[model samples]
Target: MMGNKILRKIVATVKSESKGINYFSHQSTAADSYVYSILVDETSDISSCEQVSICIRYCNSQFQSQEDFVGFYATSKTDSFTLYNLVKDSLLRLGLSIDKLRGQGYDGGANVAGKISGLQKRLSDDYPRALYFHCAGHNLNLVVQDACQMSPVIGDAMSCLNKVVVYIRDSPKRWDSFNTLLASHEEVSGCNIRPLCATRWVLKLQSVDAFLHTYEVILDFMQTAHSEKSNSASMRSTAFSLLRKLEDFTLYFSLRLLQVLFKAVDPVHRNIQSKTITIGEVLTQVSSLANFLASNASFIASNAKNDDSVAHFTSCKEFASKLHLNFACVPRGVRVSAEDYFCGLYTGLFQTASESILIRFQAKSLQMAENLRRVLEDESIEDGIIKTVSEFYDDWNYIDILRERRQWFNICRHEGLQPSINSLRTQFKSELTYKLLLPNIRSALTLYIVIPATTCEAERSFSALRRLKTYLRSTQTQVRLNNLALMHIHRDDFIKKVDLDDAMNEFIDRTTTRRNKFGIGNK
Candidate 1:
């Protein structure tokens, strides 16, 4: 009874403080298990920033018609209708209208991304306004993966880099020796080798950076291992071959190219993972990055035409300087000039990556993003605003409120207020939420604010699930697991908002006999 009271109080606080649950991120944890997380915008009383919290609605393994807990079910089948029905039932049980859902985020999978019979397609049939987007971070990873795979030279170079990390990590002696050498070098002291993971593309950047930073130490360790009597002949042979490959000019050129390309996209990648970022901002960053890469390709091609060795070497030095690589150490046997290498890399890798990003992000998603951008930027009632209202507000009916809003917008502009969306929202939050405002206009604005630009929140919940349901606690019941996971994930909220005195009073009221028996007194 005490726990039930506390749970009700917490839910009440969330529902009262939040305007509405605007977006949901869903992911399947196992073949038979799934989790749906709710995200809502909570205004901070103390600051201007809005906080996003993940309320875990369902985490279970039961398959039935109308099963409780906001739709977690276990089933043998994996089809679009099954998933859609689960979500629909869950939303209905929560008393949330399907019409209010503005966005859906998921991993790029056939069951989710398929155009004909996918979960996204099925959901769109009922809620055409709810947009489906593949997770932005995952798309960036795909870009890197595709670019690397398209070039055999880059692939082989990455393999060699991975092999180097593995060779040292697999043996304690070699690993210790590498560390010892690293410490002995003053310039590279305290640098640790980073292992590359196939699934995590960001680690590729770290791996390459670590290798370059500790190059001399790694080379020294490899030479020592080659001469060690305890080392097998095959091990020595492999070490010698790897050492030669690491020193090759072509490998360094490939590394430099990848480093530059990753550097360009890394900022945008990090930005999209943020729960607070809007789709408009993400699209802008992506478009800018694509353009940046295109210009870089053109620059490389232009430089490739110069045949003067002095000029060629200067270009090499300039490129290496940006990556902090020692261009003087590049071997003479690599006859391909730096410009030629960069041109090839730009054509084979960066250009394809840029094109791939634009291709994968759907045209409809881009159009919506542009509409939001225009709404955020424009100061007056323009064609873009009309287009937005027509496309998003067909069901809305409060023209008087919209007219008032337009008048307020003009007044703000006349008073010299900046025309940015954030500025407008900040100045007119009350008007936007007033009862007189058209419900459709309010809904559109609120949805734009709360629509998740990424599925990072869902991914984070999956990570928490893994930690909570580790091998040692694998046999715990689903209810217990769900409670524990919620407590752990929302510890911040519990610390900040939960009142101990109220909970204790409720506990005392529910267990009077136990309280009397223990002679416990309330403060």
Candidate 2:
């Protein structure tokens, strides 16, 4: 009894600090636990960097506003059935129903996203409304990984680059020397080297950029290090190996090509990680990147030839333009021709990346998201737009509901509220909009808003998990770890809305009985 009382007090204090004043007072049964962690934007205002919250959308007695931070659980197994059970149990604990679950978002892993018997498939079988979305960031990362592996030269270049990063980063002396050398260079001063990580999608860009920026500095350091008698044989050998690999024309060209290609897609990769980014926006970004790559591929094919001299001239010219150096300084004796480099390797890399992106993100849900955006923003009301949306909802009559809501949509347009798809969705949540489009259109819009475009929110939570449960605090209780993560991740909300006095009072009330029985007085 005493332990339970203390635990409750701790939970209350954490919740109050993380959520805000009166967080528990309005707490109702049948809360939507899924909303608490998913990437659904719940506010009227939209910003790319808006902080997302774990909110519960409920309607037991009456439709209530979104609630924050219900609970968190820890599980070991990640199998489909086990994950499904964990979700079901968490909802049950919160007095929420599986029938109310509207959306789910996961990375593009076979376990979670597999088509035949994945967790998403299993859950969809039971609750068809729980639409599953592949995390846009993960999909992009996979696309890059797949494309990089398509060519032996590109793959070898990446592998050698990783080795160089690891060698420099692993040794303190080498890292310090590298930094000192970088400081001497005018163009690359104050730039720190970034190591590549296989899992982190954004780090690849930074790593490649850092390497390219410090390319000359690194070569000088490696050459100098290789000559020094004080350096270990292994270090000297590794430096010599990396130096030769970096000096190769094919490797350098491939590196520069990848840097440019990834840079074009970086904006899209970043946008999908935002809470405000919608499905339509993600599709648009991917399509734009694909088109950009296709156009570049065509240009390279038309302009560049298979001759070694042309390859050397083109590569050197581009390199000189970027670094502001003379083309005459480019090293001679190139092994690969321009045609092979551009038409053979660069074309494959670009085409593979573009194709992978299109393959992953081009789906019926994406089409529906696009149609929704068109309907809201353009007021197109095209013949097939209604059919597309109806197909999304698995209901033919959904088009009728959309037709009935046309007046409300016109009202929003007249009032100048329809700025974007997201803005339209935000407006649909208003009292006036709800009353005008009441019941049917309102429900449909609610469903649309709840459908997550990416699993960025969940991925963001994992970052919090790492911080909260670091090596030093590895043994912390799962519940307590989760509590701390909630507090840390949602610190903005706590800082703005949480009342310290209210939290203290709640804690006191919960612990008072136990304290009194133990003859402990309030300090």
lDDT of 2: 0.61
Worst 10 residues of 1 by lDDT: 59-68
Can you give the TM-score per candidate against the true fold? 0.77, 0.77
For all candidates in order, the CA lDDT equals 0.59, 0.61
Candidate closest to the true structure, highest lDDT:
2
Q: Where in model 1 is the C-alpha error above 4 Å?
A: 1-78, 299-342, 379-395, 398-405, 429-441, 501-523
Instruction: Report the C-alpha displacement of residue 49, candidate 1, in angstroms.
Output: 37
**At residue 428, what lDDT does model 2 achieve?**
43
- What's the true lDDT of residue 256 in model 2? 75
Local accuracy of candidate 2 as per-residue lDDT tens digits, 12-69: 4322322211122445222222222232211111111122223333211122222234
Global fold similarity of model 1 (TM-score)? 0.77
